[model samples]
Target: MPDECVILADGPAALVELCGISTLERLLRTLQRCGITRAIILSSSAAEIARRLARPSWARADLEFTIHERPPGPTTVQQIVDLWPEAAARLLLIQGDVVFDIRLLRTLLAQTSSAMLIDSSAPETNRGKLCGAALLQREWAVARNGSVESALLEGLEQHTAEALDVANQPLYDPGLRRNLRPICFPAPALANKQAAERVLFDSVQKGTLDFPAWIHAPIEKFLLRYLCRTSITPNQLTISWAIAACLTTIFFATGHLIWGIVLALVVGILDGLDGKQARLKVETTAGGKIEHHLDSFFDVVWPIALAFHFYSSGRLPTAFYYLVVLLAGEGVDGIAKAIIYSGAGRLMTRSICATHRRPAKYLHLGVGHRADSWSAGKGSNCDGVVGIDDCCNRHSASSTDVDLAPKNTLVDQLTINPVGLVLGCADRFDEAVYHNVVFERHAELALEAAAYALFHYLQNKRLGNAGAAILSQNAERNETHCANFATIVEQLD
Candidate 1:
């Protein structure tokens, strides 16, 4: 592989219902126009649905347009890495639902430096509403991990002033991502009004969209003016969006039906402005990553709270439906974001950040499969996703597992969700704080919550089919590594 960029297609459902044939065709056209050849697509069980219903010519070539079926329940995102560690490295990862202009994607990649595709039209109310997209350079593929989503989450959790204590101490800390170029790609609304209208129309025609057609059209005059206000930084606006989303959750939980819909609309619009702010000001920094983290947090927590509220109000059935939509949307996008970031993080951390430093020895066990030929620098820990020191020749069958497991107690304690255990520590933060007391507190609480969720689901038998259930179990198991992240941070405190 000549260091290809990966494009992640989240799942089958988003592919068919969200993008439809026309939108998907448009995206393909854009990709072709932009000169991007190799990419990856993350598919779900519904992938078969899209293939059966709206079959496309590109999909016929399974080798080129690879669709990694999302695993059951929580396992959806991790499955991409668990299954295809090789392709995970070189990909222009993208989700199914998010529709971006091919021109913008090209513009994003042209930066040569680190760049993110920010939705300039993302409204303040909707700024952190969804996962923002980014364009990764070839060098980023160096720090590859099975789950790019986990990598960023790890970054966010470790984003404090004291995170630098582990540097040069047998620890790898890609100093909190500070300055990456953010290419402000105007949203469909601002870039192409007609395309934006068509997207909304398509959603309505499919009946998959709950909001009205006007929501996707050009921004309202007042909203535009509000965004132009001088005092707001994009991060503050994003946090405000989080607060609004939190409010929406509270309203939904309280049985405020009409208000919930209105709030959802508000959230959607608010999310439109984030990219705009970044573009207008040309502001990209470590602080921006913090905003991105806030956006992801609200995406997860808000809908979850709403679902719980509806369930508590005796509309368990309806709540389940909403819950599924929320989870599916977030889960699929989360996976895509992970795939995209993994490629980006690799270049930034390895070649850009670590290029000047001499390779040092670090001890850690290997979980998933290791690359037979490809490997990272000496004593470097290559997580299943990226950071390879050697090349993997797919033709060879050197499948024997390696066991240079670390003797560190904390290393042993690290468990992965949807998989079993996360073996390698990406940064020294894992050693210094992840195993400390503050982290212990968050870990205990998160574990309790995970246990409770498992018990509830099992009792209700919400695992759906056997495959889904098995995958769900695997995902939950793997998530223990990610879920305990907060606790790890508390340890630093």
Candidate 2:
């Protein structure tokens, strides 16, 4: 991948704001995240953009951000190259008007020395017209009159095979993603956008939302509409919700069920906003761990408060017994989850993050089959979802997912090379290339080996569902999403 980029900052769309930030700023952040070391901005309105754009303070300290208030002409190109000879090696040139998915950049970076982004879904008239981005080398000569748009069109030669291809594909189809879906990003660049605002909200949405959160989505969106316009930050929302949680406990302890229920529902909905606002505005913090403990504390406290209310109001004769049962169940569940997370730590985290952090609505043992059923991985999401290595393919791919076991089939093939385990060690910073080891003949040993491999990795990611996030950004590093587990209140409702 190219380490540097040249963004042509121009046009009204370049200044378009989404989630309280402009497109230029968003692109810069994305670039920094994707490992861009140096960036040169060519814009007539460079000074104006600097005034309006709020660049991220957390961006790489070593990243060079240079702005030139001119078009991409021979003089300008020569000036950039003379100052930085590394530009001769390779660099990506992007138009400021085009807000794109990072995957497109990744795809372009994977190409040989030079390539341009191709939007197969683009209209016929705009086919040769710039998709507004290209990976370039010093081999291409810049004319005296050249603009950023003309840089990609330097030669009449059209090369599409090695470059990025945005095939016209169904957004939900994971099979088509093998082509890398250059244009068909899980969160498509800014496709189908009236304003990037709606897309920003849509991008943060998960596949399986529990009932309360399902109910809360639109209400919070309405609230977010105003929140995005303000100076209020994510930590502020977190603090507000924490304060509201205390108020909820007070109402419940006072034996006011109606007020408690209303307030609790309000708090549950607002609980989602802080993270949403944080992501949309790119303001996530490490102090979020404090928020996690507070949430867990409230989760335990709220139920106790409700039980106390039931007893005080004489709403139930067996309220004390019910409270005991609730505490016992919570204790058992928490311990089991902790064990699972600790034991299957790396395997589960890598698998889940690879599948785009969408919590599973369905949990299956094997790739495509349900826990109650059995079938070879076909006519389902087996092929595209599981990263089956040579070991599994040589014998059987019966057990590829975490947290599940087959009832009928247990094909044990242990006399194979540990390619998956080896691949898992290759990139310590990335999601594991492989994560499963199933032994029907010896389930305990399988679990132990898997546990040991996973435990050593110990990434902070939590375990999630199998093949659940196939249609989303599988293996998107550093994506922080709150798990919306079903609560007793939501379940009852």
Candidate 3:
């Protein structure tokens, strides 16, 4: 509703120093409290704050807020336009030096014009006047490829004649124009529009307003361009990133917290880049999937192992038990995937002729759920039922069960026991994270089977000599930890 606004506080420490500590703090608090929908602040300090506050967000919608640390020069305007070309809305450009009564902000919001304010203190007394504040109209700027700054200059140049209609014709002349007009404000003046501008000027004179590290942002873009080249493969990049993650984890675990944290940060950055690089490079493969799986697998193990090592050294049983349950859950989940896929294959070969045949069989065999057969009158078919589709079931045996299914006899086709499926699912869940949607949709049923299997295995493992036959039977039934391929092959055959 208020359009797009940028609070451009461009100046050396002088402008910042002018406002002093109290003034800067007030400005930060006020700007944050300001109800503007999109606020852009050009400051290194702002960037630091934003980074420090970054966290995983599950927002229904995303809002873009950018803070640019403008380099010294008149060209700072160009930098802003480059950042947001399509945001042709209004802009509130606040100079670092100009402090104002909150009312001035209210008045600026109300104005429809491309406007600037006349600092009540003219510092004709000073070297440069307060050309700091401006109410920018998007349409007025030169939008050469949507450059808002150019649009601002263009609009200002074109609309200079119209400036006299708004405020103080006597104080601000077109002769004072460089693409903006000055709007005069009266005091009891709730803010520092006067001293603030001077601070900015002084900082500029001192040269403390250094260029930002934002140049790294374009590094992603550049890598994006490199990605356009036909050389890199996503799997390779993923493997590289995985190696980096492993190294980072090792470093962090081995008495090097600072270096490890730094490496961890790099790991995070590269972790983000690997995917982006993959997208940019247009490379995707089964190996990419393998890489993803490995990444997630390590993500679960390494962190917990680190915590375990730390806790174990301190003799903390609580952490050990908690991590054990988590590891148990992960193992359960992984094995569950293998079982579900295997069972899915078996059911596909069924002769149910009924509409609910396949997934009904899957659900039954999956978690030991009773047959949920659809009535013949129901319009839905087996195809509509989820988690039991032929593709998934058929594919299962190809990967996990290929080696094991052949030598063994098919004990029961379309077996409605969900025990294996349940155990497999439970085995694969690492204990660190829980209840994520990705797990819910993909891992739950499998985990159920895994939990069942681990229990069965542990029971056999416990019985020692007496349970030898049971252990052998269990081992023969499930040779691999994950047997999805076996399931797929069995179903297909």
- Candidate-wise lDDT, in order: 0.38, 0.51, 0.38
Can you write out model 3's per-residue Cα lDDT over 147-225, one digit (the tens) per residue?
3344434444554311212222221111111112223222113366444433322211211122422333345444544
Ranking by lDDT: 2, 3, 1
- Report residue 35 deviation for candidate 1 (angstroms): 1.2
Candidate 3, backbone clash total: 58
lDDT of 1 by residue, 251-315 (tens): 87787868977987887666655544543332323455665566677767767777787688775
Worst 10 residues of 2 by lDDT: 484-493
Give the higher-lDDT candidate: 1 or 2: 2
Clashing pairs in 2: 354-474, 354-475
Question: Which number leads on TM-score?
Answer: 2
> What is candidate 2's lDDT per residue for 420-450, written digit by digit as tens?
1101111111222222222222211233343
lDDT of 2 at 466: 31
Q: Could you tell me every candidate's TM-score relative to the true structure?
A: 0.28, 0.57, 0.27
lDDT of 3 at 357: 21
RMSD of 2: 14.2
| Candidate 3 Cα errors over 4 Å, as ranges | 11-24, 32-34, 44-65, 70-72, 85-87, 120-131, 143-493
